[model samples]
Target chain A: MFRIAIEMLLYDKTKYIGLLIGVAFTAFLVTFAMGYFAGFMTRGFALVSENPSAKVWVMDPSVSSAEATINMSDSALDIVRGVKGVNYAAPMYLGNMTARYANGDFQTFQAIGVDDATLSGAPKPANLLRIPESAIVDSGGTEGKLQTPIYKKDMWSYDGSHLNAPTRKLRYGDTMLINSKRVVVAGVSHTIPRFPPRPLLYTTASNFKRLVPGEKRYITFIMVRPTKNITPNKLAKRIAKQTGLKAITSDEFKKETVLWYMINSEDVGDMVNMVILAMLVGFGVTGVMLYMFTYENIKQYAVLKAMGASTKQLSDMIFTQVFISAIIGSGIGVGIAAILAHMVSSATFPFRMMWFAPLIGFLGVIIVSMTAAFISLRPIKKMEPGIVFKL
Target chain B: MSKIISTCRDIVKNFNSGEAEVKALQGITLDVYENELLMLVGPSGCGKTTFVSVLSGLLSFDSGVCKLMGEDISTMSDERLTAFRGKNIGFVFQAFNLLPSLSAIENVALPLTVEKRKRVETLTLSKEMLEAVGLDGKENVKPSGLSGGEQQRVAIARALVHNPKFIICDEPTSSLDHKSGQIVMELLTEIIKEKGASMIVVTHDNRIYKYADRIVHMEDGRIVKVAS
Candidate 1:
């Protein structure tokens, strides 16, 4: 019976191919949309995820996400360090600053600052530790962009890998001006980019203060690590009570960042809407095509019924048809999605196909196909076997 | 000479076509004997097809009994009817109704598949049936590629592949040329005799009348006469 169902579906070449395409396109749309959403979420929480050793983060009461941080007074670091369960705490400075290149092109970079002594928040590099009065540039996607020339075509020596290159350039200490002060380029780090793509530059807190001298006690956050016996959430609560500041566990801060973006940014809202629209279009096309296919094959179904095929047998045949379509279509969709993910991984855009995205999309297509199958089954159920005798 | 394979008495069916009651089968009484070729013949809308439908368990009659192999078709549950039909009855159609994606052997293997038989065994039997119907070497050909006569041969093999007790054919050769029609009729009769199965062949082609053991004519939803 399954053989017959498949054969019947394949009998009409045009309809069979059209049905497969419908299912495949739907699967593609679902996976791609979910993949994009996954990328956004990863970028939103990347800062917290990058420093896996940090247990908790201390910031001003208004700080919600990496991008929504408010400057905390430098004194907050000593206060957090004094609280119980604190193994060590250091100030992490972050700010958006325009960097003027050697060729006079100015671009915005997320300047991430760590204390000179500990190098807590910055990307750890062997060459960075060796070089003095120099900064690390994140080159995740700088092949052709503003920072590409600085790290690629310039006089820099290639060192470590591209994501974590161990090289430097600055013929006789080349420098770039950020607020009228020249800073040396030491090395490049291949850290993942944030959602709202901005180039990253790693520097010391002292250099950060040197670049922006207006704020005397500028400390964006104080990253903390708990002792062996204490949990981060418990330590965070104790610190917040002692310093009258918002001390949150890294997980809480990560969630807050994603929520803040979802609520406050129109672009984030648009992305979510796009995902939903893809789902609607995918399901809609598959449903209509399957229904039309079933309608066209009503006579064949009647013939089968007249031949004494049990209702269960007939139902299984229909379900099997849809099941096969969904599986094949989903395989193609996931394959294309993986290829798409690979294509944009090197670009400046934040695109990621998470482990669960494709699985979810595949399951979603199955559900849609099943629904379409039921819709197609209604007409078959009502078909009269007497039609087979019609001239 | 043989036991009764199917019997219908005072079978009636009606349809409501736009406020008018159309009596498609006013009263149909028929009996098919084992190993007999019974042809139901009539003009258009004469209930010949309806009588065949009821006899084959594909149609229901109003307030009448239809018994196949001494079991009442109306008294059986839907599932029982389907199982009975799949196991005991075979059907052929005017269009040949050969699935285009399946080869001749696969179409013949359908009844066994419905019976949940193993694929290898069903195909082996289907191949033999096709060969018996003079479709040798054509088992792998799809219906689309086969000529009208070959397609009808495949259809007959499909109908009889399970060795059902009865076979039903609806205008089995209406679309064929006279030569192909005669060939199909000969093959159908020979195969029925070989299987010892009763058959109800509803057809308008008069050229195949000679193959029938008995012929019943219908007109205006009633049996007009029996010709032998």
Candidate 2:
């Protein structure tokens, strides 16, 4: 009976191929859309997430997410460092600066100013201190997420693929103007994009102060690492009480950022819409194609039924075809999405590929195929086995 | 004297399409014994097909005692009746009814496949049956690739592949030429004798009446004449 199901599916080459294509299309569309949305989730907390050194973040009392908050007083850095469980607190200048490239292209970037003494909240590779006039430009900016190909004056462009290709390494002398102040590129940091999709620039706190002169309250997020034997949650509560500010653990802050983006970002809603629409398209294709194919083969089912095939046997045949198609179609869809994730990530569009995103798409195909087969079974059940004697 | 394999006593069946009700089978009483070929012949709408449907458990009788090997198929559940039919009955159709996508042997192996037979064994037996029907080298040919006579030969191979105790063929040779019709009848009758199986064949192909152990004629919705 299983063999009959498979052979019958393969019997009509046109219908079989059509069914496969419909399933594959469903898989591909759903996976790619959800993957792109997953990328948005990464972008929502790009700033605080990359700096793993910071265990707790202090923000305005009313601020729920990272970007939605007002700037903190520069003196808040000292106030947070005085908390009981605090090991060290750093003042992070989270502000945007207009960068004029050597090629005269002006772009906006998340200009992050790290603590000059401890350099507490800056991200890897910890060598920004080695280069003179040192600053790192974010390379993970593409698809209008930020600047395209953050180029340096002397270094060759990094437009190639794979390990053997030339790396996007920056030379010591390549410089860009930050508000007309000379700022040189020492390295490039690959960070998950920001909510507003801005490129990132990492510089010392003094350089940030020089670049954006005379901002009265330059400090934005007060990043703190808790001392050993103290969890970030306890420290956050204490800091919130003592400082009269909102202090949250890193995970809570990340969750708040994600939730804030989910509610406020129109792009997130649009991405979600694409996922829903793709599912409908997939279901539509699968349902209509299977219905037409089964209708054409209804008589064949009648003949088989008359020849002593039970309803279970016939149903198994149809479902077997559907199950096989679902597996193969999902494989094709996830495979393409994975490949696209790799390619688009290099160019710095936030295309994220989680293991479960494709699984969701796979489940979608299964539901679609099963429902379609169920709808098709109505005709199979209603068919009279005695009709085999006619025609 | 052969043992009785199937018995249908005064079976009644009707079909209703809107307000008009047609008596498709009216008081059909018949008996098919082991190792016998019982042929039912009649004009269009004469209840021959309907009677055979009732006997094979493909259709329900309003009131009658219809039994296959004394199992009382008329009283069996739909699942039980279908299982019984798969185990004890095989059918060949007038149009050959071969799935267009499958090759000759695949169609022949279908009945056994439905019964959950092993693939290798089913295919091997199907090949043997196709060869028995003189379709030896054409095992992989689709029904469309075969002649009308060859298609009917494949249908016969399918019918016997499960080795059912009783075979029902509705006009199995009516669409074949005279020579092909004679060949099909000979193959069916010889295989029945070889296996000691009972057969109920409904046909209007008088050219092959010589092959029947007994011939029953139907008219309107009742058996009018039986010729032995």
Candidate 3:
């Protein structure tokens, strides 16, 4: 019986091509929408997903996510480092600074400063500690737009003033003036595109001290790593009790970041709206296409019923046919969507193809297709078995 | 002495439309005996189809008693009636209503499959029935691919595949050409003789009356005459 249903569906391919195309298009749109949504959310928290060393984060009680700045005394780091079951802790300085290049291209960048000896503890390179008056920039920010020219000279002049040359051109790297001090680029790191989609420059605490004098030895946050037999939350509680500040585990911070993105990020809302629209479009396309397909075969169904087919058998046949169509059409749709996502990612699009996005999209297509097929049962139930002999 | 396979008593069917009640079958009572080919001849707008539908347990009468093999069919539930019909009653329609999706053998095997029989046994029996109806080489062809005569032959094979105790045909050859109609009637008669199953066929075509063991003529929802 299932074989019969399949044959019937395949027999009139030309007649049902429109329906197949409709379902396929719906599936493609749904997958594309969901893929983009997942990509956007992941990128929104790339900083949290990539950070490896910081087991707990201490913040002001008012702060909710990484993008929020919580002011705390520099003494907190020392107190956390001295606690039992504590391995190491370091102060991290974060601020926004405007950078001006020789070509009159001005860009706002996040300034991150760590103690010279404890740079590795905060997930920064040791090379950044050795390069005085120099910073490491995020590669993704510069790789495409600012194709800096590579030069081997030890020194270079920007705005007719001599500054130490960058060790590497570093994609978007350039000699820039920060608060009347020259800072060269020493290396490039993988880009992290969390809340603020801007270039990042990592420097030592000494450079921060020199550039912004009398700024008070105040760090925005602290990073900590625990020793054996110590959970992050327990260490965080101990640190909080001793330092008079809040301490958060990395997982807690990640959850807060996601919540912050959902509530505060403008793009997140827009992407969610786009996903809802895509689902509606999918429902519309599938419903209309499948309804029309069943309508065209109404007489055939009547004939089958008149020939002594039970309602269960007829309904089962119809369901089998729809299931086959959904599988084939969604398979093609997801295949196309994956290729499209890859192409977009390779290009200049701010998209990431997470490993789980395809699975979610495929499941979405099946759910939407089954819903459409179920709606088509109304007309089938109304079919009269006696109509076959009327003609 | 032939056994009485089906009996209808005091069958009455009415149609209601906007406060108007129209009588379709006025106390139709008839008996169909074993190993006999009976034809119910009637004109348009008569109750021949309604009477047959009630007899086959496919429709409910307003008031009537229908018995098949000494069991009251009118009181049977839909599920039980369906099972009973699949087991003991076979039907052939004038449209040669074979599913276009299935081949001739598949169409013939439908009743057996509905009975939850093994596929091998069903297919083998269906193939044999098709061959018995003189459709040996066309088992793989769908009804749409066959001619009217071949399609009718497939329908007859489906009706006979389950070895039912009785066969009910509604204008079985009405859609065929004269020669094709004659062929279908002859094949049906041959099958009834070979299998010893009683048959009741309704038709207005008088040319095929020679194959009937008894003929019942009807008018205005009432039986007018009976001839044997």
Candidate 4:
């Protein structure tokens, strides 16, 4: 009976293919949209992700996320260090600065200023930096939005600023003006992108102060490592209690960052909407197609009924057809999504192949299949076996 | 005296078409005996189909008794009736109602499969039945791949595969040519006789009436005459 059901489904090549495509489209659209959403949220807390060793983050009380920062007073670093169970603490500066390339192209960057000595919160190969003198650009930005022009004989004018030169990539020793101050790119670090997607520049706290002058205090966050015996949560609470500032474990800060982005960003809402719409479309198409398939074969079902097939046997046959389509369609959909994720991520878009995305898509396909099967069962249930004689 | 395999007593069945009630069968009374081919011949709308449908348990009568092999079918629940039909009655349809997706052997195996028989056993029985119906070496051919005569042969094989007490054939030769119809009737009558099972063939085609052991004529939802 199961084999017969499968053969019946496969008998009409056009209908079977249409059903698969409907299910596959749904799975692909939902999974890809949700994956992009997760990728963007992950980038919402890129700073925390970079500094895995910093278990606790101390910030001004008003700060909700790493991107939405308020500069803490310089004394907050000392206060965090003085707290019990605090192993080591370092002040970090986060501020936006305009970079003017030699070719006079100006771009805004999120400048991250780590401790000159320990380089806390800096993405590595930051340890290889000559203490406070130079900067590192994120690898993604080096390929996009931040390219420097290479010289061409006919492309250049008298002065370098107006030169219409063919571009070569920025590399080591590329110098740019940061807030009218000269800074050299010492190394390129591979870092996760930010939510709003700006180029990241890493430098020392001293260099940061030099680039953006005349601030009384410039510490945006203090990265703290808890003592071996104390958990980061306990240390954060102690630090918060002592300093009257917001101190939270890295995981908590990441959650807050993701939550803040989810609340504030319209892109998240759009992605979620797309996922829901895709699911609905998938469900509708599958349901309609299955119903049509069953209706077209209503006579065949009557024949079966008149030949003595029970209602349960007919139900099993319908369900069997549905589940087979669901499993295969979902598998094909997820496979396409994985390939798309790889292609889009290589093009520097926010897409992560999270494990749960495919699982959710597969489950969604199953649900759609089940609904379609139920819809198709209506004709079978109302069918009279006597109709076989007439039809 | 042939053993009586089925009895239908004053069976009445009605249909609702819009606001009007159409009487499809009016007090039909008949008996089907073992190892006999009973033909119910009538013009369209004469209740021949309705009578067989009730007798075969594919339909229910409003107020009458239809007993097949000594069991009252109208009193059986849907589930029990379906099981009984699966185990007792075989059907051959006007259009050869073989599933287009299934091969000849698979079509023949359908009744036994409905009875929850083992796959190997069903296939073995189906293969033999197809051979008996002169469809050897065409077991893997789908209905569309076979001619009308061949398709009807597969349908006949299916009807007899489960070794039912009786076969109900509705317009079995309507779609076949003269020669094909004769061949199908010859094969059907020969197989039913060999199995000692009765058959009820409801058709308007008079060409194949010579194969019947008993013929019942119907008109305006009533039995008009009986001949042997």
Going through the candidates in order, what is the number of backbone clashes in each? 3, 0, 0, 0
TM-score for all predictions? 0.82, 0.79, 0.83, 0.87
- Evaluation by TM-score, superior candidate among 1 and 2: 1
The pairs that clash in candidate 3 are: none
Candidate 4 reaches a DockQ of 0.64
**Of the candidates shown, which would achieve the greatest TM-score relative to the real structure?**
4
Runs off by more than 4 Å, candidate 4: A60-62, A98-106, A123-144, A147-190, A211-217, A227-245, B1-4, B9-12, B17-22, B60-65
For candidate 3, write residues A224-285 as lDDT tens digits: 88887899999988888877777888888877877887898787887778788877877687
lDDT of 2 by residue, B1-228 (tens): 889999888888989855798998888889999999999999989999998888888777788899899999877988788888988898989988998878999999988877878889999999999999999999989998999999999999999988999999999888988889889999999999998899999988888889989999999889999999
Per-model lDDT: 0.82, 0.82, 0.76, 0.86
- Model 1, position A342, has a per-residue lDDT of 84
Best by DockQ: 4
Instruction: Kindly report the root-mean-square deviation of model 1 from the true structure over all alpha carbons.
Output: 6.4
Superposed Cα deviation of residue B152, candidate 2 (Å): 2.2
**Model 2: per-residue lDDT, tens digit, A1-391?**
7766778888777777777888888888888877887777877887778878889998878889876767778888888888899998888887888876544446777778888877666657646744655787774444432222343332233443222322233444567777778887776666676666667778888888888888888778888889998999999999999999899998899889888888888877776777788779777987788777778888899888877789888888878877887788778877887888889877777678878789888888888878988988899887767878888
- lDDT for each residue of candidate 3 in B22-61, tens digit (9 for 90 to 100): 7889999999999989999989878888888788776678
Q: Say what the interface RMSD of candidate 2 is.
A: 1.3
Clash pairs, candidate 2, are: none
